[model samples]
Target: MKDRLSAFYWLHETQFAQISSNLITSQRRKAIDIFETEGFPTVRNEDWKYTSLKKLIAPNYVLPSPFASFDEEEQVEYKDIKKFLVNDIDCYQVVFINGRYSSWLSQTTHSKYDICTLGSAWKKYPKIVEENFNKLTKDDGPLVQLNTALAWEGLYVNVPKNIVVEKPIQVLYFTTGSTPVFNQTRSLVILAEGSSAEIIERHHSLTNHETWTNAVDEIQIGSNSSIHWVKLQHDSPQASLTQHSKINQEKDSKAIVHTISTGGKFIRNNLDFSLSGPGAEAHMFGLTLGNDRQLVDHHTRVDHIAPNCSSHETYKGIYDDYSKGVFNGKIYVHTDAQKTAAYQQNNNLILSEKASIDTKPQLEIYADDVKCSHGCTVGQLDEDALFYLRARGIRLKEAKALLMLAFANDAISDIQHPSLRVKLSQLIGRKLGVDMSTVL
Candidate 1:
């Protein structure tokens, strides 16, 4: 596998030998450097202690070819249900099929905000796209580098200053199975000062086929602005996904991120938030429902560089069958970041003996006047509570379903969007394979 990586590096060198962009070529070189130094992360690494890539790096695997055309009719179908909407927020939507941007299925209009493909943005605004493209992630990790090296099309959004857009913007990515295809999707969002908006990222699979998706997102919020970001992943059971999100918050800015992972073969999400100004606030929330042999992992980090900043994080996972879940979170407060407050918690519920969870919540505080706390809990359904429910004339299955649904009530009810909240609850119930009447 190591030899193959080296071979891939040389192969791309010859493949993109005549590319014109100096900046992109420079990034390619930088990626090679990073990969050379870091290589691929193994189980020995502290961050990847719980996940393995032995099968992922097998010898027979190859990078997916660049896809220029795909049948729109063959794309995955998504019902516009309640979980797909929220309140009266009419949003601009963009849809992608099999890693290719589809203009026919997307909704676009010229207003205070703009949405377009990454390739188009690069061709139109070369300087801006070139300067800030991969600045969010400098790691030479395989997935990150793979995305940088093969990225062709993605989403680019720019919101004008002082314009409080009244509608949310959605980006939906649908993967079509051809041959374990790899989709490298990139998103860059910039919110000027006094601008505010909400962004929703929805991911789904068109087929229950094997594939790998590497997605990277970069977001920057100006002073006195707020941005709400939500991500939902419901890929096929044979598909694996890796998503990385990097956000920079300015002074007096507020940023909230919500991540829900429900379906996939192996999934890992890395979310990074950096408060570069004083009086900034950031919130992170995540939920995962895993079954079969699925493995869902969430890693989050929040760094406070300025004083008077606050951050709160919470993540929960439910596992059945031989499923596994992992949560690693860290909150760091610098020495000069006085009066900083941070809190983190992770909880998991296991329904089968074969199910397992690995959780780690850490806090690194350098300021003496700061308040920080972290905790994690892994447990099973309360047998006593189940017995009581059954004793009240509820069937065994009905009682268990009610308890499980109630256990997940906190996450679902905390959702700000009424429609999405209802949709998530119903989908969760379906995933549990329990009748809603029994639980409700």
Candidate 2:
């Protein structure tokens, strides 16, 4: 807490004005005040009891310069970062280097739709940023507040009404610097009525420098619209990440969010969905593969505010070595939300004796006519299945990997994009030390 406070004080004194302008000055100040009053969440906070930021916050991380220009000698080639992209897929790409937009490496469009950076939108279309910025974010968390106060560069996408984007949009953030640094980024996505789009967001570190990223995303789906949002976190082991996503759905709209976390030393994800109108639906899925001493925590909430709304959530984790995992999910059916249907499930597999997992699924229903259920399971590999596979030609490592793949396929099958599913499957196989190229 002291370290965080000291860093905040230093940033407030040195860099606050540089990051804020007349349009966002007041909002930044309010956010900074909130962070100062609330501080970092501790075990006393019910929502964060299973996860702690003591180690992540202990370092006195230097805030990266927002407008720092890279020299010609420091420029990164596309070939160096192309391996992290989905090479088989044709999509619009937006790349950010060290918290700044890389126009030379980005392919964006402003014709039928708006696909650009927050900085561009703020400068060119101030009204759009003014109308949507900070509207969906909750002011209850300190990390989010800090992001609100300091976020400068990220993706901004707006899909017009009745238009179906044939291609997905890929937004990638890469960090490259000699010194350990901290960064804050925000993304805003708005889908108009009857529109549909797919978006993929990822974070990667090119250097081994210790880094911390605080990211926030706000998504609003209009009536009869749909969105498929996926987040991939595969940074270096020295990196730490904290992300929050708030999604709002209108009448007859649909939202699907898939989070895959396979890297980073420490990661915490907060995902929330609000079904604000009748017939709205939300589907949430997550897969986390943690090894070594890494820690991955996911906290999710689905609020059914209107009648005839529904939500489905499933999360699976595989922990190896001395890694730890946490899953906390809640379903809230309001008093007026009759005929609400909500279901949640969390499962985990601990591969080593030292690996651990903590899971809690809660349901709060105020309407008597709602149907809500939640269940969780935690155990080791199925010995019977392992033996069955080993009895065949499969080796022990291959058998274990096959079992884990089968376990994660439950969520992987939900992916709507074929190339993305295959890419994720290959990454998962590599993480498990198995060759899945032929199987996938």
RMSD of 2: 2.1
Per-candidate Cα lDDT values, in order, are 0.76, 0.86
What TM-score, to 2 decimals, does candidate 2 have?
Answer: 0.95
Candidate 1 versus truth, CA RMSD in Å, comes to: 3.1
lDDT of 2 by residue, 342-398 (tens): 989899999999999999887888999988888999999999999999999899999
What's the CA RMSD for each of the models?
3.1, 2.1
Error of 2 at 1 (Å): 7.3
The TM-scores of all predictions, comma-separated, are: 0.90, 0.95
Clashes of 2: 0
